[model samples]
Target: MISRMLVKMIAVLWVGIAAGWLNPAVSYSEEASEKVLKLHSGLYYTIQKGDTLWDLSERFFDSPWVWPDLWQKNSQITNPHRLYPGEQIRLFSREETQTMVVESRPEPEVAVEPQEPPYYFYPPINSVGFIKERPVRPSGAIFKVKGNKAMISYGDLVYIRPIGRPTFTPGDRFTIYRVLEPLKDGEIKADVGIQHCILGLVEITEGHPKFAMGRIVQSRQTIELNDLLMPYEARSPKITLTQSKKRLEGKIIASEGHERIFGDQAVVFIDKGRQDGVRVGQSYYIYEQEKERLDSKKKEDLLLSPVDYGDILILHTEETTATALITRAEKTVRPGARIRSPF
Candidate 1:
């Protein structure tokens, strides 16, 4: 019992020392935007010019990486950089600050940069895509081309049969996609959802109710026969840095550039989406499973920890999948890589 109290006291003292490093500076900007703020038992220190969250977290937590928890605690500062120069951040006692600690460590000689390369040993959850359940089938596939061409490009004419019927208004628009590959599933079935590459968009100009005539209006990639079509829906979700409430495990199912590998700012698709509780603005860390490597000198295999690339932020979410931008990556990221929450 005495040891427990001693441990707790040491923890609080450590935190107090860390928090003491920050000195209050008056916030100067009046036009700057303010965010949601949390109430805690601490003195208020106004933000000032040249101040960065990294600096503040380091000052208060002794480790710059705790900024996310700091943001979460404050909640009001939606954008870390948009902190109003004049806004006040409440500083709290060490005991109170203990609630914000995501990780604890002994005192170190060097200060670490929170946003530096390989921000986490494991990627966060939002960046990892997950599919909790099988997704519904798309509208239909490109049955045949106007000239019966196997492949078609922008402005090409095409015909499509609604998944089961030819019952659509002639002027409806649809997004076209090429089925890429199937993802991991407990069981394999032809009807199960698979990763898809959006080929282009088509607008029905003329044709029968069951079979419609349409023209490829825009093509990010060449359109081809048998490419599936989905009802087009305009989307533009406001994405911000957000935290996940629950731990979710998922993988990168697809990528936008169709590149063999991805890196920072590269858009990728995850298997998890809205139904799985993933939302736009949430972030995740990307990592590849640790593998055993051959050591030439020892002539033996050495196991290495999972390689952390960096974080990915969910830009958009659908029913069973989400698209994310790899906001940071220390190494090349690729589909099948895993993602999870940092905390």
Candidate 2:
């Protein structure tokens, strides 16, 4: 009787193991269901498996780059990087009292205070293009690319050669860029400056007397062979809004991506810069020139008053030009659009 019972138990255990192995989908479902407990609902999110600040920000706020705003909005979360399952994340706050009910029990009333708005604007400093008044004096050039590819991006390795002197060292960083063309003012029909489009960033991993090897750390666009390298200067994206004291006006000379028409959140270039008292973080109004046709011998023309249609915020400034981002617009903003300070 004891031997018969032992044999029966062994048969049951073997059957269970075989079932689990044969039905792989069932095993996968059980593993997947263990990760998540609940989903987000009504101004609150119950943290689940694979939930991150970036993902939550992108899901709720419509942008992954605005994760800092999400972190600033929540006061209960201690660490921005680490989130545990079953934890609570406040999506946003309201001025009124918040009531939470759980498991048929009512929790205490929590009053949420209104927070002040942010004054500084964060722009993508490295990805935007700028107008250079003079020719670019490159530090080096990317001669060869690794991994049998012509175009490279983030984390790709490339060999660089110095232009005049070899001053590259391990851990040295450089900005990769390429000259697009000479930006010319459409109104004046003259060349304003050279336009340089930022490609990516690289850091030296191995340095030699004549040549150095580096890996691409950050890429805004595709990095190609013979891309010019410049000394990288780390700049903060945060720029405080400042009231302009001078009444300045300029015309949009060009825009990023060379698009003929661009609107909100698009990066553009203006003819005004530091020489014209243009500073970063200053806001400008975009205006459209109004014209009227006169019926003369050959149908003469008359210029009317300009009308404001949009707003632009300055991001970076050169000697004679400035890079700006369109903040608000109700009409089409394009090249030759006028820009004036708000005073």
Candidate 3:
């Protein structure tokens, strides 16, 4: 009887140890099985004094309008335009996730206009030769600090000197013509054509003067300037028509690297250009597509909506594509993304 009891106790002890070992192995295997998913992630930074949504987006995502997508995902945010201190934002992955819970509130609805598709026009790249001209002196001259006062006031005939720069050889000759108006209160204001002009070029001259200066020769009948020697030139006018609305898309071709112009603002480059209807001042929206949950259920219940990551504005455009200053950014604008017209 004693031997049988001891055997039974030993057998029970062995069984307990085996069970403990198996349970731990199973638990560890289950825990390790959890998979990590990588998706595009964005962070919401709180607004502080002297902060605009434009700059904030650039700081966080490298684009400004990216706030819209963030706003779209976080329905808890009642107001999109204004943000309060200590607000929380949810970061979503490319994989589907739970829909954000927003309180039942009647939100104002706005209609989104359909944007026109972009048209591509390829202009032959050609090198042309033209004569360089020298600027003539105007009748009168004005003295003001460079940034303090308008360098060339509206309707003021000023001589532009190409100070021996590589682009402007010593003997290059160019002509200057007066535009629509004269300088006002020391500032020039005029609408020349596609570009708004304030001061008119009266002449182009070679060689830089010790002190850069401009003189107004022919002022409107009532216009008068201090008795200063001015520049002179014959006036010729030309009119150009502005292009209508158009759309274009392209990827980032290059970058100007990083710069801190105003606080943390930066500028970057793209691959689209004038051939694609991109001009000097055209605006575009930068976007990166993200996979999101879609409400597949055929019921009148809340569902997931397809969304994108971020957006930005274009500053300068070229023929194939143009370089854009990151006006607004949500997340970091990376290479190999799509930039399209917002409209």
For candidate 3, what is the total of clashing residue pairs?
52
lDDT of 3 by residue, 57-115 (tens): 44334467666654545443445566554333443321222121122234687698686
Model 1 lDDT tens row, 149-201: 76686557788877865345656777776554455532332222555565666
From the highest lDDT down, the ranking of the candidates is 2, 1, 3
Q: Comparing candidate 1 with candidate 2, which one achieves the higher lDDT?
A: 2
Q: In every candidate, how many clashes are there?
A: 21, 0, 52
Query: Which lDDT values do the candidates have, in the order given?
Result: 0.61, 0.71, 0.36
**1 versus 3: better lDDT goes to:** 1
| Model 2 accuracy (lDDT, Cα) | 0.71
**Which predicted model would earn the best TM-score?**
2
| Model 2 C-alpha lDDT per residue in residues 192-217, reported as the tens digit of each score | 99998888778888888889999776
Please provide TM-scores, in order, for all candidate models, with all chains considered together: 0.48, 0.66, 0.26
Ten contiguous residues minimizing lDDT sum, candidate 1: 118-127
